[model samples]
Target: MSHRIVSKFGYYSLAGFAGSALVQLAVIWPQTWIAVVALGAIALLYFAFLLICIKGVLKGARWAGVLNFNVLGVDAIESTGIVLFFVVGGVWTCLQIL
Candidate 1:
C-alpha cells in the first residue's frame, strides 16, 4: 500500500479511537470531572502523536512506517477490546437499571 493511504488510515484510526474514548467516558461516568479531563488529555496526546506519524510518513522515513504500522496494529486491537468491553458493560448496566 502507498504511504499516503497508510498515513490516512493511521490518522483516521487515531481520531476514531479518541472519539470512542470520549463516548465511553460519557457513557460510563457522565458527571465525573476527572474522567472528562483525563479523556480530553488522552485525545489531545493521541492527536499530537498522529500528526507526528503522518509527517514522518510523508517524509519517506522507513522507521516511521514501521512505527506507524505497529502503532496502528496495536490501536486496532485495543479499540476492538474496548468496544467489546463496553458492549458487555452496557448490557449489564441496562439490566441493572431495568
Candidate 2:
C-alpha cells in the first residue's frame, strides 16, 4: 500500500521534471529548428508513455516501472550533457574569444 503511494508520488515528480526539462530545452534552443522539431517528437512520445503509466499504475504493470526507469535514464544523461556543455562549453567559448 505504502509502496504504491510512494511510487505514485515519484510518478508525479517524474512528470513535473520532464515538463520542466522539455520547456527549458525548447526555450534555450528555439533558434535551432532541428532541435525544436526533435523535441516536439520526443515530447509526443513521452506523452504517450505518461498516458500509459497513468492508466496502468493501478493495475500493477511492471512495464510502467520499466518505462519510467528508461525515461529517467535518458533524463539523467540529458542533464549531464547539459551541465557539461554549460560549464566546459562556456569556458571553451570564453577562451576562444580571448
Q: Please report the TM-score between candidate 1 and the true structure.
A: 0.40
Q: Tens-digit lDDT track for model 2 on 38-96? A: 65566556566655666776566776656534433656445433433333433343344
lDDT of 1 by residue, 9-74 (tens): 565556555545555656668775466456556655665776677688778787796872644566
lDDT of 2 at 48: 67
Candidate 1 whole-model C-alpha lDDT, 0 to 1: 0.58
Cα RMSD, each candidate: 11.1, 13.0
Best by TM-score: 1
Q: Quote model 2's TM-score.
A: 0.32
71: Cα error in model 2, Å: 11
Q: What C-alpha lDDT values do all the predictions have?
A: 0.58, 0.52
